[model samples]
Structures are given as structure tokens and as C-alpha cells.
Target: MADRLRSIAFAIFFYGLSVPIVLGTPVAALLGTSFMRGYCIAWARLGVWSARHILGIRMRVEGQRAAGPALYPAKHQAMLETMAIAAMLDAPAIVMKRELARIPLWGWAARRYGVIVVDRAANARALRQMMREAQAALGEGRSVLIFPEGTRVAPGETPPVRSGFAGLYRALALPVVPIALDSGQVWPRRGPKRPGTVTFRFGAPIAPGLARADIEARVHAGINALEP
Candidate 1:
């Protein structure tokens, strides 16, 4: 009962503060990518702060943090990691679906902030466009973050990495850093979030140029490392 109450209060506090920031997204876009990225990062940090204080959730990152241009394929479990990564990484370019990119003012800001939008239905054409944008982001010294599973999975689920990940790996020609986390244990896809520590475990980086099967196998194991 207490946890439920805390979750409700956290939601109210967080979203209430988020209104003005969401409204300012387009204006931030006009200031250029740097300012927009910072604005987004600040909002992410705000989420982290509220989660810690109001919801009693904390984050712990284990293993080496990647520096420079690399591919970070993370486990998709909940919305927490999405905000957490933005707060943690150094201006990462997150790969999100076109549906999200189609959102009103938020979508405009995301595009201007340089998020790599993937159109799953477009197949090859979409893959090509994603690679082009990813390469451009790397050139700007930003790491690309993607959830290979494509969508959030409940705890204990082991879904195969989507085909697009390997294609992006081959196109980017960068080492892959797999991030495993069990956020769903607390911040589940549905239901009230519980108070607990969410751990993100970064596995060893796999060198680029591995065969599709090999890279996919390694990443599949890496991102599920934290799973019981």
C-alpha cells in the first residue's frame, strides 16, 4: 500500500514538473542540437532525482563505461533505463521507433536533438537511413544506444535480438558494448513501481566485423547477463 502511494506521488510530482519542459522542447530545438541535448539530459536528471527521492529507487552501474563512438545494445525492460541512459551517457543518440518520433512537440524536439528514428515497416530503406544517421552521430563523437529486442520485455523473458541490430553493427563498424539490466524487477512494464536498486551491468565489448550469428549470440548473452 505504501509503495503504491509513493508511486502515485512520484508520478504526480514528476509529470507536473515535466509539463513546462515538454512545452519548451520546440523552443529548445531552435537553439540547436547542443542546447536541445542538454535540455533533454536535464529532464532525464530530473526524472532520476524524483525517482530516487519520491519513489525510493536508485541506480547502480557496473563495469567499464564506454568512451567514444561505440554501439550500446541494452536490454529493453522498462522506461526507467531510457531516462537513466540519457542522464548517464555523454550525449548519446538513442534509436527510437517512428511511432515515438511522430509524437507532437516532443517528436520535433527529438528529431532536432538527433535521435535515430527507425521505421520497422520500411525494411531495407529504413535500415539504410538508420545507418547513415548513426554514422553521422558517431562522427560528432556521440555513442549510439539501441535496444536490440525492439520493445520492453518483462522480467525472465529472453527475446531474440532483432535483425536490424546486426545490420547497424556492420554499418557502424564500431565495437559493441552490451548493457544488461533488471529494471523490470522493480519498474515493471505494468503495475505500480516498487522501491529497489536497478543494476546496469555492462559486459565486455565485442570487436566489430564478427559474423552476424556470432555478434548476435554474444549480444544476446550479454544483455541477459543480469537475468536470473
Candidate 2:
């Protein structure tokens, strides 16, 4: 009961505050990407803060943070990591689905903030576009964050990464920093949130240029390293 109530309170507070930010995103965009980056980061931090205080969920991040431009293929178990990534990373260009990138005002802000939107059902052209944007982000010294599974999964489920991961890896030619987290244990894909520590374990960087099979295997193992 308490957890459910807290979850409700957290959602209300978080989304309520987001109203004004979403409305002002256009102005932020006009201020330029630099200002918008800061704006997005601030919003992400607010989410982390609310999760900690209202939902009683704490974050425990392990391993060293990656340096320079690299690829981050992370475990996707809950929405918490979506916000957490922005809060933790240094202005990374996160890869998200086309649906999310189409969410009206939020989508507008995300595109302006440099998120790389991927069409899951797209063909070679979409792949090329994704790589181009990812390369541009890397050129700007920003790491590219992607959830290889493409969508959220339940705890303990280690789904094979989508094919696009390998294509992007090959195209970008950057080291891969796999991230494993147990956010689903606390903040699930459905139902009320629970109160527990969400652990994000960052694996060591896998060097670029590995064969498609090898890279896929390594990332699959790395991102599921924390699963029981």
C-alpha cells in the first residue's frame, strides 16, 4: 500500500513539473543545443531525485564511467534507466524507438536534444541515417547509448540484441561499454513501483572491430551479467 501510494505521488510530482518544461522546450531549442542539453539533464536529475525521495528507490552504480566517445549497450528492464542514463552520462546521444521520438512536445525536445531515433521496422536507409546521426554525435565527443534489446524486458530475461546493434557497432567503430542493471526489481515495466536499490553495473569496454558474431555474443553476455 505504501509503495503504491509513493509511486502515485512520485508520478504526480514528476509529471506535474514536466508540464512547464515540455511547454518551454521550443524556447530551449531556440536557445541552441547547448542550453537544451543542460535543460534535459536538469529534468533527468529531477527524476532521479524524485525516485530516491518519493519512491524510496536508491541507485547504486558500479564500475568506472566510460571516457571519450563510445557505444553503451545496456540492459532494458524498466523506464528508470532511461532517465538514469541521461542523469549519469555526459550528454550522450541515446538511441530510442521511433514511437518515443514521435511523442509530441517531448519528442520535439528529444530530437532537439540530439537523441538518435531508430525505426525498428526500417530498412537499409534507416540504418544509414541512424549511423550518420550516431557518427555525428561521436564526432561531437558524445557517447551513444542504446538498449540492444530494443524494448524493456522483465527481470531475468536476456533477450537477444536486435540486428541493428551490430550494424551500428560496425559503422561507428567505437568501443562498446555494456551496462547491466536490475531496475526491474524495483521499478517494473508495469504495476506499482517498489522500494529497493536499483543497481547499474557497467562492464569493461569491449574493443571495436570484433566480428558480428563475436560482438553480439560479448554484448549479450555483458548486458545480462547481472541477471540471476
lDDT of each: 0.90, 0.91
The alpha-carbon deviation from the true structure for residue 135 of candidate 2, after best TM-score superposition, in angstroms, is: 0.9
Residue 119 displacement (Å), model 2:
0.8
What is the alpha-carbon RMSD of candidate 1 to the true structure?
0.9
For each candidate in turn, the TM-score is 0.97, 0.98
lDDT of 2 by residue, 128-208 (tens): 999999989988999999999988999989889899999999999999999999999998878899989999998999999
After best superposition, candidate 2 residue 105: deviation in angstroms?
A: 1.4
> lDDT score, residue 211, model 2?
97
Q: Model 2: residues >4 Å from true position, as ranges?
A: none
**Per-residue lDDT over 1-228 for candidate 1, one digit per residue giving the tens place of the 0 to 100 score:** 998899899889999989899999878888978998999999888998998999899999999766667899999898889889877786699999999999998888788888999987767777888989999998998999999998899999999999999989998999899999999998976778999999999889899999999999999999999989
Query: What's each prediction's clash count?
Result: 0, 0
